[model samples]
Target: MKLRAPISTAVAISFGLLVLLGIFIPDLADFRNRILNWAMLLAALALLLGLFNLAQVHWQRVRGREATVYSAALLVTMAITFAVTLLQGSDSANAEWIFNYVVVPIETSLMAVLAISLTLAAARVFQQRTELMNMVFIVTLLLLLVGAGPLFGVELPYFTRVINPYINNVLALGAMRGLLIGVALGTITTGVRILIGADRPYGA
Candidate 1:
């Protein structure tokens, strides 16, 4: 069992290294493409599995009479969406109508909920501790809100055109890039640790 873990880790790391090399090394392009195709197929399978899992959970809830209304609604919606896509074809006018009217509104509602949740969290943080970081976050959020010119339909040359663009393009972009870099570095470190068998997240 101990030997199996080390061998599997080594094999996994070898493929990872190969894929990394393929990004910069021209000779490994074909190998990388093949790997990517496999990944795509796997992703598709995973998505299908997830859908099945969702359906199963909802069906159980319906059967148990636990949140039956919500479960039934979800199942019905899924059925309608699937049928529409299959029968009318995804690009058909019927599908497009459903996407635009039904799907879009639902998505927008979800986003609004998320925004409200974030706002509440921010408010709570400010209430707990009036730190410099929290103050900066509030200021940044306000700037972004003001920068959202379409919402209010009011534009000031100094604030809207000059300051908004600077905050969005320069300040926001810089922070996003820094965040991405941090994520990449963390991923690399975790990968290295796994490769070295220092971290064994998978079953033994």
Candidate 2:
């Protein structure tokens, strides 16, 4: 028999109660706020666990005489980043500059490099299937790109008139409503499962 069943049921019930109370009882607002704060604290603790795991892996690689250089670099980068933030404080000019100048540029460059692979994949798809489907795909992509481009230039009034309403009202609102419904359903299902002792993620 699976030990997870009982734990899952209890967690599901607790989560469900929290959600219902949060929505229906104005007096429970403070309790809900505290729970959110506790969640953030838990997330920070999880991050510490991840940092510890990373350090352990790098230390083993360096000490075992395997991939020492890469391991060393990882350790050095972690140390420097941690020290800079801790010493200068996150709100300080130096820390902000380091984040904006170094991290943002690296992230943007990596994203740009990844975009090239996407472009190549699109080309391959067109080459393999040069049919109506490919034409639809290319046209949809062009419309999306042009719609998102700078609005100050020459206006394609016809394209905008046709696409803008569908995209804004249909696509955006549909996505948001779908997401909310999914969250609500998921919460209810999890609550029911936990109440019945069947959906535990924790060892409890």
Candidate 3:
């Protein structure tokens, strides 16, 4: 018990350094791949454990005296989906039916709700601040929404052909690339912190 934390930290630091070095050092590539494979296996196990934990929590909620119809429904749906997928295989017609009809529709509906919510939030922000950037954001958002599909069953050539394509292809693409760069930088920073033992995400 006393030596556990130190031993864990040492192992983590060594593995991190080895993996980092392996990226640039060809000699260590094989070792890096082996370590990565083990990490993947561990990650899969962790995911399975997390799923079981989720089901257990939902089961507890369903059993509680409080009105938890949603929990019960979720548990039942999850069980049925899992059983179907397992028995029929993921590529089977029944599994595909559940994924296509049930999963896709739910995801699509959530995305629609998210789009509406974001639009409303942007409107509220514009109302409050009315800054130049906020004004631009609101205008661009409106243009994107309006040009996303035909308006009043008629497609406007100017918006549909030009503005929408330019906004989506150029402006939005640039913004997404910037976001990806930011995420990459943040990940590197986090990795460095973990490597240096400043962060102990592995319960060291």
Candidate 4:
């Protein structure tokens, strides 16, 4: 009774697997859509729980004066975003304006900063001459960056016509697709582990 976690996990896994098998099992089709809707509702609830948890943690940090300014900014951003979302009713012009101006620019700036940081780190790795993989990585990185940008790819009419297309479309796209597939597989594996009670965060 004290350690029946595996049994509980097994029961939950069996129920979920039966629902999931509805995709291929014709007999389960009647319940499939209902089960999926329930799953989606649960997922939405989980997201709200996450947001509340985030707010709580940041509020605590603000009260403690640990990185108070950043925590305050985060809370303010969340409040404004939430208020706008509710007031504008999701599809309204004001909601779109907030998303386009406030959210998009912040996200774009973060991505730009990330790219610059990665480029600098790659450059530093190249300077060390430590491993063959580092050189290969740097070469691939440079090709993708240049081939995707106007600096060398689009500006040069020849590259825009031939070289850039081959590098960006054929090579880079193929690599990215492969990476996405790997990520999907990894996600499936983790989900399976959770179902099987092999990954037991709930027990903790």
Candidate 5:
């Protein structure tokens, strides 16, 4: 046997135990809630790690005199954002305004670009494959877009008549139900694996 036992097993066990405790023991609910809070705290730390990594990479680029202009801009933007966040606090009016006007607009633009790229990619897939799955996907996407859009004057009969209602009520509800079921199954499986000492993700 290897000197270092796999850390994953320990992680899986802890996760499994927590999952079961959350589900079965109502009195242990507070423990589960605390665990969730800790998880979120850890997630925030991970985000900080990302910011650290970004700064490190840009600093190295600046030092090496490669793409120094872009590096400097990144550094400056990060510094300004960090300072504003720290001084005014993340929840303050100034921070909110910066996030709303600057960050939200940039994020929206990026999302739009990504959506366009995805559309092109999907179109290419349909062109290449020409399969039933691709046809179904394209049709579903078109239906979804038309149903969601505000086409006031030129109302398509099929969409306005049948598909819209079906999607809004039946499909949406069904999707949510499916998602809940999947989550439950995943939790159960994870818990079982952890209890059995078979699936440890943490180094515990």
Candidate 6:
């Protein structure tokens, strides 16, 4: 066990360097692709393990004497969904129906709830803090919500047609881009750390 750590670390760093070098070297691309495919298989296995762990936890809850309805429902739904998807294939009409009817509605409902929750949270913050950032957040949220559709069946041209598009296309787009840039930088930093053996999430 003690000897294994250095070996693992060395293997990890070697693979990392190879993958990085493969980008500019055409000859190494095939090797890189092979390594990536192996990584992907590992990732899929990890995901399967995660699902099993989740189901086990929920199953435990379902077996317990207290408040088990939600857990039972979740387990049943997951089992049914997994079985159907596996049998029918993801592109099958049954799977498509399940996705469209079940998944879409659930996602839409969750989004609606999230929007309302965010607005309420913003309002609470504004009420308590009365800070400039909080005020801006609430005002921006209100404007976006009001501008989303016609109010009382009356279209507000200034908001719906103008401000809504501007906020969504310009301000929101810029913010999203900035976030993506930050994420990319963070990913690079993490990869570098892993390569240098500064971070060993793989128990190296």
lDDT of 5 by residue, 1-204 (tens): 662345666555576578667978999888888888888899999999999999999999999999999999989978988898999899988788889998999999999999999989988987898789789778877897787655776667778668978886898789889999999999878767658876545554
Q: Which prediction has more favorable TM-score, 2 or 4?
A: 4
Q: Estimate candidate 4's alpha-carbon lDDT, on a 0 to 1 scale.
A: 0.82
Q: lDDT (0-100) at residue 83 of candidate 1?
A: 91
lDDT of 2 at 27: 89
Expressed as tens digits, the lDDT of each residue in 164-183 for candidate 6 is: 99998999999999999999
Compute the lDDT of residue 115 as modeled in candidate 2: 96
- lDDT on C-alpha atoms for all candidate structures: 0.86, 0.80, 0.90, 0.82, 0.83, 0.89
Best by TM-score: 3
For each candidate, what TM-score against the reference? 0.75, 0.72, 0.80, 0.75, 0.72, 0.78
Ranking by TM-score: 3, 6, 1, 4, 2, 5
Clashes of 2: 5
TM-score, model 2 to reference: 0.72
Candidate 2 on 86-148: residue-level lDDT in tens?
Answer: 998998887788799988999999999999999898888877987997987877766766776
Clashing pairs in 3: none
Superposed model 3: Cα runs more than 4 Å off: 1-4, 143-180
TM-score of 4: 0.75
The better-scoring model by lDDT among 3 and 6 is 3
Kindly list the per-residue Cα lDDT of model 1 for residues 1-204, writing each as its tens digit: 446577667767777777878999999999988888887998899998999999999999999999999999999989888899999899999889989999999999999999999989988887898889989988877777776665556565666788788987898899899999999999999988876667767665
> Candidate 5: deviation at residue 85, Å?
1.3
- Point out where model 6 deviates above 4 Å: 1-4, 64-66, 140-180
In model 5, what lDDT does residue 188 have?
77
